[model samples]
Target: MEEKFDLLPLLEYIPPSSLDYLEWVSVGMALKHEGYDFHDWDVWSQADSRYNAHEMESKWASLGHNGGQPVTGAFITMKAKENGWLSRQYEGDGMETFGWDDEISYERDYRFVDKAWVEGKEIQEPGDNWNPVEQLQTYIQTLFSNDDHIGYVVDSWQREDGKYSVRGSGVYTKTAEEILNDLEKYKDQKDLGWAVGDSKKEAGAWIRFNPLDGKGVKNENVTDFKFALVESDNMSLEKQNAIMRELELPIAALVYSGGKSVHAIVKVEAANYAEYQKRVEYLYKICNKNGLQVDSQNKNPSRLSRMPGVIRGEHKQFLIDTNIGKSSWEEWHEWIEDLNDDLPEFESLAGMFEEDPQLAPVLIDNVLRRGHKMLIAGPSKAGKSFALMEMSISIAEGLPWFGFNCERGKVLYINMELDRPSAYKRFKDIYQGMGIKPANIQNIHVWNMRGHSIPMDKLTPKLIRRAQKEKFDAVIIDPIYKVLTGSENDAEQMAKFTNNFDKVAAELGTSVIYCHHHSKGAQGGKSSMDRSSGSGVFARDPDAILDLIELEVTDSLRDMQGKRATANFYAEKIRDENPSYLNEIGQDDFLSAAEMRKHLAAALGDDRAWQISGFELGEVQKRVKLQTAWRLEGTLREFPKFEPVNLWFNYPLHVHDEVGVLKDLDYVGTDKPYNQRKAAVKSRDSAEKKAERKKKTTDELISAFSILDEGDGVVRIGKLESYFEKSRNTIKNWLKNQDVLMIDEEGFVSMRLELD
Candidate 1:
């Protein structure tokens, strides 16, 4: 039985006030359908101001399983997902998952200082040399400009809990310059009471990290959204200081709080209040993820930091350092992200030589290796998906793929383009066309993600988690465009996008294979590596790049193939129903439809021949015309270059060209100069057509003579004209062009005997 998930927690991520009427009702419907109590819906709906008690009770009673698809918990999941809720798979103890839309760092473990290894650094009060005025001066100078208004709280009162808290909204009209001038004028005062207001010794003073508007002290009253406060009292003061420094947080001012925590005035440098909130949330999230356990309440732009140079009870709240880490917000962010790159460490070449590591085993022999990546690039309608499906079946059954031997192993085919039913039918059709029994059918797994495909970066972790247990040897994504994350033309963006493949390959230890379309225009003039669309990184990053370019099939070749196919079709029937007839037919006789028809007539007689003739040979020709020929060229990193493999995309299956007919066919564009090649080809085609016409005319004349000749071996020109389906003069001219016959003035034609 499938387990039912409790979706009540997902409601927390979604705000009830954000939804429309229908959406709000759907939530209740989903809750009811999932067998949750009406109170659960009522409690959740109460968050929205528009909620009415009467409407809620009425709507809750009305929601039930309708005739159509029921609104299940999945609707709630989707709503929650849209509101930035990631599934529980990403959550951990004390570690909240990043929002669905959050930029995930490449590595999850961003810890810089391990708590077990961190030692507490003792906090020291200013001694006899302490200058309280200078401490206050330095704090203001580091965080504020002369024109910026600063908000600070010096007045305090004790709460019922016996903890001291700030008394009113605090002062917000003082500028750094005015405060500095006041301090300089009162240098002899010895205490900050003369500069600002006197505070109780048991409660330290506080000042806003960000400069505020002179009007008020709320978040909107903040002028420059410059800095945020990172305070954690849960951990040892020493460890908090160590982590702040190790994290390289851009600190404008590092102040020691009198009682418990250190207030690190981290530089967020947000452009506005909205941006400030996001940056602060990210900063706090990162801190918590790395074991800092930051106090989450300080996310507002106008939040306070410990006021330096103040005395609280017996401890001093004073400046510890200024500008001690990365200089700016961008710099700090880049540094932290760089620390989480997750790239392998450098190893000594000598040590590696002595150890002699084994190379990854071949997955598709000479084409790809296990735990590597391969890209199959081709033009649209090139059957790239079908080729990938063939590869999947090949790997699953240990069969050959595109003439390359594949190791038998489990495969996961990610179908992002095709619908589930169509994708399934395609696989079945290919299997039947290839005439392979699915002995290891269980080895192939299909993940149909048609409408549900996410960006490759986001999908990689989820894919890795699911496939890790399967121990798949290869994972093939049908077409990458569905999950392509960034601008395909930008090299840097594409590089980041393609790196997800590497992540999947490394994490699951499987070969990652995917298909991409070729760039527009003639691909033949370019090398295989240059054919894939977008940035050159897509072509170069993979371990193997196999490009498919269509080969030009000539009209004569199609006709010959059509005849051969028709011949074989009848030959099979003859062999199956009347085996003795095939013995009388020569091997070469099967190459012509006419010869095959004669044999069929001899074997099946008039009745069967009439029935067989009803089958149109032109239909076979039409099918042959629809078939496309392709040449597979490869650029390999782990093996030597192999010759281009030629094959035909005959509908559901791709068959190798064993007869080498496609070998000499030039790709759509040759390397020759365009204009010159076009002229040359035109001239050659004209001359070839003239010769072909002459040969065809001569064959008809000779055949006419053979049928219309009298006992004396003489043929009348008029009779020959009628038989040849041309005018008498036209027949005479045709005879004149050929040396095989003669036509006299009386219009009597005679065959010429060879004189040896």
Candidate 2:
């Protein structure tokens, strides 16, 4: 089918019965024109053998594709694992993919010509003076005599698999001469020859191919050469040579990381097995530096490959956006097309993420990372500040407060409304329950009021400088309105600040969490872009956006019966999640049951945190956020093995999986909030009751504290216990007399004392 000198045709010229199997040389050269798959060797002896359709077409397609200087008496075989190519590798021998050292080594030429021959299906060509392998052997043998580093096989023997087993030791042993004598010994007995040379080295070729082109006469049975791989826009001579130089094999394409140019592909001529291993290691390194996971890569034929490409400096001829970062395969394809139209100056986007060590967690692992430009726009009384105050504390501490773990990071509360100390006190109460000192919360930086604000992006970096200069890992912005520089929805204005924000956060390698309120009438805890009060720019460039909604939050189970249950919904906006518009039934407002085509667009793009709250379906959404919303109920004690993501994702107020949801308590109506506690084991026996009593006393001593107003007559332990309806022993265990108890001159119970 093809006009080229296809080995398939040559195959027909030989009788299969004469040879048990086909050898490597023919397969190697034929693959150059034919597809790599070539023929099914198992079916080679079939009488009805017909060529593969694709291979037939490709061979004909490349009428003029042939390049490289031909070898005269050439022979091809697998680099016989035993005594062959690998064992020949040595250090300083430098088994690089591609290398162009000066001059042709003449002694290397004769050895290859002296042994080995070409064997096809049934055709076998004995010794020829121009054998490339013999030349290679001669070059190697001569090198051993001249250079201490170059070595030849110390010993080799033929294995039944048609290969030579070789053994060599030490680091860089030069054995060019040993190889030549060994070839001589086999010369008469086997009628096979072996040698090596680089048609790639121009000066070497000058002494070998053509003197006019700086090549000399060829003595080996070498035929036209083959390039290992090719990867370039063009197949010009210069390009081919560049490929040969970078990679020892003349590969056509260089699918490196940047994919910008071919200067990346390289070649290594392994002098020994050790050098060969080093080459493979180098290939893996290139992949790693390019952000490619070796385990994730699934290329079978890939002996090695370079990164996409390197960014030399400011490249205009070929352009990339520095800000755009690494593009996916499809994304890169689209970007390149766009470049053709506009010719934007390309910036090196690779290695940008590596600039920050802290950000490495998000980049290296497939875990999610987000940036937020939240707009808390709800009406004043909608508990906007309350929601923010709560969420901000959560991010500052790795543990969740109510029922959610927000990709916890540093927090900066920029609250213009609340008094600083009041904010501190509220945080203090939460911290008291948390059992950690609030003073040691380094990541939580509060910019107490509006005037202290700078651009949102500057928040993370400046705080990071403060944290590291001071020691913190995260930054938080509270009540988003205080720190915003411009109108919320203005794209230009919002973009300027958020871009700066993301840039600085990325640069400093810190995760910034912002707390903002939802707009009035916004449906849920999370509001879409349309509902976000400002420019709605937050929806565009975030790693993740989390929306928190609270229905009427009741402190007690009795209070939740008639109110809209607090509802929280978080949508992962990055990647391709279908429009939240429709569910299984293709309906948008499953409740309003509206057939809207789309869910509300987000306030920010990418995956960033967005808080949305307010819903009557606290019961339904809790199931949904668990099965649907944040998705898990119960407590850490319940799913002890689950990850942080599973525990407390939907923090509906009072839905403390740590304790239980608000519905479990009577904080608002049922009795007193103090009565709420984990279900305790019941003990009916006297001993168990006594143990329980002791435990209760211990609890009182550890946790209970009394409060009083203008109390001078604090009372003695017995009286204090009697007034509170607690046992005297329980009161005494808790140090009741120190605050509530009073001692008189006669050491009698006194009622006057102060609560310390």
Candidate 3:
């Protein structure tokens, strides 16, 4: 008898407890009983839809198969149904019974098989040919021979019993050839397992794609990029594979991830990281187009996939498809050269601009809006980084930054210029200066990317992935120039960098702020934006640009150290906001009372003095340079003949006396000059000084109460006390003097200053 291939014994070798392994074994045995064995020339070709005789015969035999057997779709489906591993996932289907008249189609339909069988045992070929280990090594080498900068981890292995063992090795940067040369070192160790990174890196960090070459030599570049599809948890492996085939992805290998999923690696033409990302983007597009979920998260360039011949977690990880996308580097390049270049579709703009008419979402009011980009530029050592740190902490803690409303959120600070120690100290000092507990700064993450000197292109995606993973609401990149490899003056290069930042901001739904240095000179004649050094593109690209202008040293403004005590912050550019009144109109261009009356008529739809409350008047002033709603009670003192009416925050016609004004009008009262106002008498100081301080404190207390009333009357007593630094009784006494401000039945203070 010709050497009989004993299918029963081989099937028994597979653990029966594994549905996938058992399915494969059953199919091979079923085929054996049908008078067809691996010796038959067309068994696989006839059973699987993926093969044609002319296409598979030569390649299939070359994979060290004596044509003994391989798993087919029919076997897997039949075994799955028999084992009851599926839910109500199938309409109807079963494999043909070998000795019975009943027959069923073995095609997988709606079977909810989250996992499937792949060849576990290596195929043993005849004498002196390629051994199983070499065959696997060759397969791996061929899989990535056309690509460069591949990272692999070879320090881990699996035993024959399927237990994963690791020798504590880190990622090794090498080429396919380098890995191939070291195959013998690991071949005899356990099951000879390995894994390859999906992304390429330099100095242990993902290399950014930049056009210019810097001083340090980078890893060899990869022309042909590889992508892997991690099966969705919602679908069966059969369905996923079917979708991949339907989309016609150039799949190179199928790996059992030692769990319920399989990783399908595909090969695509990519000349650089830019091209690689585009290709991956297209992959996602096509999958979405076809209603398939291919685990887009796995497409990152730094992602790692299972090595073809590795053993993982009691399973032999072997290649299910060889001979796919396999070619020499030159051949691949040549082949791709002839194909038309295609780009991924631009991200959708639908529903992006839809906004509430009355309220807009803000990451930081008038400064850093969600999904917007900001540039904070100043002269070197002008505290731009310091200010950014303060803002980052405020955002993380949900506190206001420099009196600007801020939404609480997770923040990421990418430091590209400062050293790690300096960066740490800066953050620590900022928290301490702001009176925030270091332990309380929960959501601020700092990435110190300085000494390594990675370029922006390679760094952008990595940062994006980090932000996406961490769900950051704001990302601050310190000294944007350090992250850039190109000259700042080059508009094209700067545009590219800003565009990347904008893209990341949009994708993460967060605000991005980049610190920059200002050009040398006084900013007297220049707008806030014009002060930034580098191409105008940097200034123009962001949604907002804030400039910190340090004033010349003056005796009155200086601190004890005689340094310039303060800097003026200007919102040079707020895309949705009108220019500031102080910047647009000269200081001497104060609106006359008639002009104010006319402006109120136009703005509030009435020429008569109108009631304005909350931020309404301030908002109008910022927009149209309107006169402030509140006038000093002492203003009438200048004209002693005029009736005394105290000014409050509410706009237009209302000025109240010490007691009350018309029911339709409001007033504030002052017995002394506004500048001469004083706090309440807490000590036995002179009555003159005490009176002066009391008026000042009362004025501030009312203003504080107005601010705390966010269109609603409820005001926190503690808030007022802390903001005014006054005792509760003093605040209550001041409130008692004004009939418009009173405590409600709820024990909360309410502002009843509105005109009826």
Candidate 4:
């Protein structure tokens, strides 16, 4: 048999005025629920908080159940340990009959009250009662039927007749039966009570339940049902129940709060914060339609309710149920997920476009449009967060970003990596740099979730609820990798994560910007989609994806920090609409000059004999591949002051004598002169075809010179000029050039050209 102590029937036998009796009752209920034999424990019979082990043994020896029965502390502890509830034992003061171990404490230890265990125990029917104690006990049992969390406050109201009406207004804990038994014993203690409604706080008008803090088996975990109490000034319980029944709400229990009002304890089985808000809103609207009074202020999740099982004024509050069984949270979640069906009636696409004149249906502005998702990707420690911070402020402040008009509205930036202090410092730095006061930047809320990586499933509902509470134009989640628990490379998992954000955007009508990391290596060669690490879902799913690449350090461009300043901001995928923002801003040209200079400084190291041939310049330019030639030319103009030298083939080489500067390049037959080459400007000829033509021309010239040199060892420059059908000066210059022939001071030339 399960050793059970029926504390309910014993309530009538115990005096209501004794505090010691009440405490003993509480201890006994807790002990009995854990299947412990408390009757033989004589220490519990005394009112003192502490009892000696010696006295416990003596009392156990004298007690009826202890006659030849094992009732000593040692036996009880051994039995407790055998049950696997006790972790270890310690020898403390001999007076300590039962207490928690100072070195370590376990939840199931005798000292710690497992309220959930107590609440789940089978109800023990009370004995025949003829006193007020039994009356109050029975009434208390009837009041808190569902075992919801409650609080209490002793309050007095001034009546119309001028007499003060006093009562205990309170709520109950998870173990309402156990707590209620103890509460009745303290009826004489003025204003003594339990937590009213769903919380342990005072409730003036109506009780409110905190959705995040429901009374569940795990006290710390959120419960499925959020209780909402309806209170009225001049409403009867019958009338309130009638209206509640008419609304067909999921009523867990109804309680009589006090004289003129009733508390309809409606329950909403919400899976998350967003569903909780929706359910409560729906409840409020339904109650109002039925002409029942409900305090709108009580709609907040943290609002308090009246404590069940407490005597108020002249009457005992009793719970009434509509006989509907408890709703399953799994089913309720499905119902809420189907809430999309209740969305406003649809309108034609053309009609929606016509309704909004200046605004497009989807695109709000250049930065981010309504109903669209954006990705801001960069390498780690590449100032991605800082760039996003500026963007967030711009959107919040209605300021232009990169010359793109920002659709001003409230923004939320969720930082999952940096600590609050570090994030704040960065924000301050950006604000000061922009010459904008922190206070001037409005509607931008920052949530620094350091050390906590909340997954998308858990994070989405919170963001949705927050957006619902206060309409947000955009929500930026920095370093999305931190909060994303799934594998980035897994297409299915990544798609699900991104789809969640898309849902948030669609539901809240707010744009979401996901700050992400790019894969290692320079981003210049790869397309924006390929640059981002992860499955293609991350790149393909978003409406717009932006890549910030640190351009390779080159000769002509250096960044503001005297480093390579060129950062390529690519609008990798801009779907459909072409916002002027992408076209108006040219970051490559804007920062290329500085970047080129920085690159040159690094490449020109050990400048001895450093020469820049047109071919070499063309090779560097090909790598840089900036759209415009002006950046290259501008960087070239900044080179160390040097005179142009005409070398082999009359090639112009900029000769710099300074160390660490490019020196004169050796003239080669294949190298074209600087003035003769169109290295910077784009050419009409294909590179392959141009190479072929140049080879043919060189062969023809060499053959012609070879034929002319057959008559003599040296050829006259004038004869060659006439034979080649070229000008005399041109021929003379060609003779003096390095590639053609060796010329003597006598004006004679050896035309036997050695062609490379």
Clashes of each: 1, 179, 29, 45
Error (Å) of candidate 1 at residue 441 is: 1.5
Candidate 1, which ten residues in sequence have the lowest lDDT sum? 94-103
Q: How far is candidate 1 from the true structure (C-alpha RMSD, Å)?
A: 19.2
What's the CA RMSD for each of the models? 19.2, 27.7, 31.5, 28.4
- The C-alpha stretches of model 2 lying farther than 4 A from their native spots are 1-397, 401-412, 433-443, 450-468, 520-530, 552-654, 657-756
TM-score, cand. 1: 0.69
Best by TM-score: 1
Question: What's the CA error at residue 387 for candidate 1, in Å?
Answer: 2.7
lDDT of 2 by residue, 1-756 (tens): 734322343333222221222232243344443443434322343432233444544543442245754321112111111112221224573332211111111111101111112121121122223333343343333212332222122233445444333333211222335435655665544322222221111111111110011121121211211111122322232342332232223222223222233222222233433553455344433322222212212111121222111121232111111111222223432432353352347666676555754533431022234432333333334344555656565665555544445555665565666777777776666566455665437666666754566655545444444444322234455655665777776789877766655654553455554545545553432323333455566655544444433333333432332222221132222113444422333222332311211232333332322222224234444543332112211111112332222122232232333423433322212232222221222223666877776666544433322433125433344544555688865555455424433345443343443458
lDDT of 3 by residue, 1-756 (tens): 645432332232222333232333455455544455454424433433233457444543353245655444345333333333231223345221121211322222322212233212333212322233564565555455523435444444555544444433334445556556566665654233332332111111111111112222232333334443434433455555555554445665655444445566666556666777776655554444343444544555545555544444444444555544434334543443333233355654665457534433678765556767878776664566777887888888887765567898888988877889988887887676566675547798898887865677767755665565577888898887777768889999888877778667765778788888877655434555677888998667877776654433222312311111000111211111333333443333222333333333343444222443235444533422321122211111111322322222122222222332221222123232322333333233576776787677657756887788777767878777787788988777777665556776555887665668
Q: After superposition, how far is residue 166 of candidate 1 from its true place, in Å?
A: 2.2
Misplaced by over 4 Å in model 3 are 1-360, 556-756
What value of lDDT does candidate 3 attain over all alpha carbons? 0.51
Q: List TM-score per model, in order.
A: 0.69, 0.27, 0.33, 0.33
Full-model lDDT, candidate 4: 0.50
| Local error of candidate 4 at residue 495 (angstroms) | 2.6
